[model samples]
Target chain A: MSRREQAKEENRARIRASAERIIRTEGIDKLTMRRLAEDAGVSLRTPYNLFGSKTDVLIALLEGAGFDPGDALALRDEQLVMEQLFATLDHIEAFFDSDEKFYREVYGGIMSSAHPDVRSTNVERVVAMCQELMTHAAAKNELQIDTNTRELGRYLGVQLLAVLGMWGAEFLSNQESIRQVRRAWCGILLQHCSNASHRAVDAAYQSVALTGS
Target chain B: MSRREQAKEENRARIRASAERIIRTEGIDKLTMRRLAEDAGVSLRTPYNLFGSKTDVLIALLEGAGFDPGDALALRDEQLVMEQLFATLDHIEAFFDSDEKFYREVYGGIMSSAHPDVRSTNVERVVAMCQELMTHAAAKNELQIDTNTRELGRYLGVQLLAVLGMWGAEFLSNQESIRQVRRAWCGILLQHCSNASHRAVDAAYQSVALTGS
Candidate 1:
């Protein structure tokens, strides 16, 4: 890489670290571009030049904190589609539990923000991830042949977003949030599961229902 | 009907009407207690005495605008449980559609507000309504014997709130929001349905899937 590129990368890293610190300690409301630039020892224009807006900065922070759809998709080969979906939920719960305060502050801020970009970025990523999973399941004949995997994925994505929103808003604990997601996802998948996959999905659904008690 | 009691009722109606006008013409943020009292031509203390807080005032406005669980419950005797559930969703969609601007402003404001009361009130009301419907379904052997209606109700409530939140935020069209809710609700209901109602629920599911195409 060029020296200039290396410097840019280092500067971006510094800014992200500063953002995390500010958001964690002071809350998202305090992490303005000016404050971030001053805290990161960069010019005011540096943040705007790099990230464009506060919403973009928050999105960057989220991505930097390991909010990757790739991680969820990686389980595709190792587990059944239903199990992989549940595992994805587990991963999300673990991600939030890893730093409850940080995730809550970032995610809650994005959820409540009037800026549509951040929320759409999050939703679109999840929808793509779900679509990929559903496509794989359909390939294996686990899902009905006629299933509109994209719409099904979109449905689940919105539901998952809601559960996460509740958790982000402190309405549900990490465990409860994950449990609800699992139960609801299992229930929805049960309706779409082909005969070959119905038992597996139903088993997961029963487990969620039992444990939820 | 003592005159004093009747006068208090009249005052509340006037204050509620004034709150609606302000919230409708201006945004929810502009409908402060002081502004409401001034607009209503009542003493400032009148609003405070009548409603505990701004959140309470918003809730009153919502209730006054036909946001009633009883409306959903009234369908119990006239229709099957699954149909009644979907009809309830229709009722909600119609309620929101009736005054898109007002509902959007009030619900969007409450959803984004840090105050927990408004969101919880909305969720709790839906949860109770769902539980009642599920109980009625179980009574007719439409649902599994051991289904936890309360938890199921809560799950559906959160999902509904999420869809409504998306609609209120303008991320979804009114028709699209209701369609998504109906589709997801059908899928979830299909899982808890017994042999007696599986065909009916699956039929509803198929209709939603077909129309969604």
Candidate 2:
């Protein structure tokens, strides 16, 4: 990149880092433009010029922190479906678990806006990303089945996001609870897969018999 | 049923009804003690005499509207696990869908507060109710088994709450999206129960073959 472009990118990163830091120490609600500017050693108008508003700053925080799964398509690069899914979710867990206050602020900021359009569209995009991830999974043996792929994709995607939000609401110190819940989830999915293993044989037999008859 | 006691009981019901009305109309945010008095045609001190603060009014609003699941014990009494689970979640669906304004006000109020402990505790209690409901389902043979009861309960409880909050957030609103996701969940949970159901047979087989050699 050119020197000017590089400088702009560096400035942008500094702003998001400052926002994250302010939220960690002072709470998301307390992250005023003035506070962020003073902390970042920039004029007050700099934050406004860079981020437009606190909510916009949050959008940047999510993006710059590499928590935006939107950026993950680049990582897909013919990766396994289940691997991609785990990578996406693990990134979220690690990102949020990095600091309780930062996660809390981002979540609150996402939902605090007066407009439903912003929140709704953002959710829609995330859900769509999950659907795409699951589709890739089904193509491989990661989630092999005859079930409706799109339907199942939406189901798992939405369920995980909701869990993330609820878990994210708790203090980062509540990692114990998050860990407990995650272990339970893995056990349930694995056990269920084992249980359904027999069903696959039964299903194949039934399909064959019906066709044979 | 003494005259004085009867009068007190009637007045209390009247005051509670007035609080509900205010919430239904103006929402929990505006349901102040003074507003309740004016709505109920009672004295200014009547609300304070009955309930101390705005939070108390919200607690009462939740109770008066029956979003209070009573407790885990009572909610677990339904016949089928899915039926019981849906019934309990239905209470929330009804509450938030009661009035767009009421739902937003209550949720935002609880989340935005400096003191989120009480509200967070209440959410935990609600989650516990789901766990209890799942356990009861297992006890009654409504849910099948392959996994341990605790993990199954946590999985169902935690995941369902995640979906519920998203529904509350209005992120999962498309009717098609809701129905499709719910169906996949039904399939997944039924698959879970089937596994849970077969564990006993496996344990029994471990003891000995019928040859008893």
Top candidate by TM-score: 1
Query: Model 1 over residues B1-95: C-alpha lDDT tens digits?
Result: 99998988998999999988888788777988899999989999999999877878877888887797567665457567877777777788888
In terms of lDDT, the poorest run of 10 residues in model 2 chain A is: A204-213
Q: Candidate 1 DockQ category?
A: acceptable
Report backbone clashes per prediction: 0, 6
Error of 1 at A17 (Å): 2.7
Q: Model 1 over residues A1-213: C-alpha lDDT tens digits?
A: 899989888888999999999987888879899999999999999988888877777778878978865677554575678778777777887888898878888888777776777678778887788878888888888888777888888777877887777777777777887887777677668767899788878877777772222
Estimate, for each residue in A1-213, the C-alpha lDDT of model 2 and write its tens digit.
999879767777788788888887777778888888888888888788877777777877777666776765333656554445445545665777787566666866776555567777676776677667655655555554543455444555565556556655562233533443333223223322223233432332232121110
Per model, how much of the real contact set is kept? 0.27, 0.17
Candidate 1, residue A77: Cα displacement in angstroms equals 4.5
- Locate the minimum summed-lDDT window of 10 residues in model 1 chain B: B204-213
